[model samples]
Target: MTETKKTTIVLFSGDYDKAMAAYIIANGAAAYDHEVTIFHTFWGLNALRKDEPIAVQKSFLEKLFGKMMPRGANKMGLSRMNFAGMGPQMIKHIMKKHNAMPLPDLIELAKEQGVKLVACQMTVDLLGLKPEEIMDGVDYAGVAAYLGDAAEGNVNLFI
Candidate 1:
């Protein structure tokens, strides 16, 4: 018998590549008709911003850091590991090779595909960011809300 897979992802990594992985996986899972909810928390909340456009810095130091650090969701271009110093370049190559859809496009796809995105309220309060900062399409909820979803017998993963 094939085991049914239902998942809720508590995404805590704000690194660019990590966010991308979560989004991509959620999209795929949703495509397969599984229920998916992504709970963005802590640093991961950075990826949900509406005003901040994710971009790679041009400075040599920032580029170097980009190689060493995680770029966050808006910037993840292709290394599976954000801190591996190959994230952006690898993402670009993978997108090119696979004709991968862009993040904005992916967001639309996920919406149409029934993927649910939730931003953690605690993170928002801690960051002093308003609810308006997050993209229009996402839902804002507290930890208890996340737990409520996780409690529904879905496979919960902290990614």
Candidate 2:
């Protein structure tokens, strides 16, 4: 019997393009019959945020963090040429014109294809993000969990 090949990605960027790249790679790996995991940490957690604020009681700091961060993939900024946040909008327009899948759609597709999506528990705590702040169908785990996946992965990426 042969073991399945595995791919692990540590998505640590908040930029729209970087997040899109990570999801695209993960989807491609899943298409190639690889078990894939995308571990979202730090600013990367922004990609997994919900579009609407959940009605939950939060501490002052948590509320502040929520207000400061982008709500979801659509609200994310680009890593470069942001131009006060116009860069991501321009890129989104180009992507739409090119008929490419948007980041949010790519995320949904990845989920449908059984790619694992994990939010870093430590980062979540550090950011003061509650469970309701993130999208549904995501697992919360610590660095040890990510390390375990990466240890057996044939391809490991830090995006």
Candidate 3:
């Protein structure tokens, strides 16, 4: 019997392009029949946020953090050449011209392909992100869960 491969990714960057890259890799791995998991931590959790604001109660600091962080994947800025946030807009236009899927669409494709999307529970608590704030169909787990997956992965990546 052929063994199914496993791929684990640690998505640590919140940058739009960076997140897009992570999802693209995950989708590709899934297409190849590998069991894939994306462990979103710290700022990377922003990619899993719903665009609309949810009326969740929070502490003052948490509220401030929410206001400062990008609300969703589309709102995230580029890692470099941001040019005051115009870089992402420019990149989106170029992607459209190239008939490339946007980050949000890529995320949806990942879900359809049965890729495991996980939010770091510890990071969620530190960032004041409630389950209601994150998008649906994501698992919440701590480092141990991710480590278990990574330990058995044929390929492991940190992005």
Q: Which candidate is the best by TM-score?
A: 3
In angstroms, the error of model 1 at 43 is: 1.3
lDDT of 1: 0.69
Go through the candidates in order and give the clash count of each: 8, 0, 0
Residue-level lDDT of model 2, residues 25-138, one tens digit each, is 999999999999999999999999999988888889988988999999989999999999999889989999999999999999999999999999999998889898899999
Sliding window of 10 residues with minimal summed lDDT for model 3: 1-10
**TM-score of every candidate:** 0.71, 0.96, 0.98
User: How does candidate 1 fare on TM-score?
Assistant: 0.71
RMSD of each: 6.7, 1.1, 0.7
Per-residue lDDT of model 3, residues 1-159, tens digit only: 599999999999999999999999999999999999999999999999999999999999999999999998999999999999999999999999999999999999999999999999999999999899999999999999999999999999999
Query: After TM-score superposition, what is the CA distance of residue 29 in candidate 1 from its true location, in Å?
Result: 1.9
Candidate 1, residue 98: how far the Cα is off, in Å: 2.7
Error of 1 at 12 (Å): 0.7
Distance from true position, residue 1, model 3, in Å? Answer: 6.6
Computed on alpha carbons, the lDDT of every model, listed in order, comes to 0.69, 0.94, 0.96
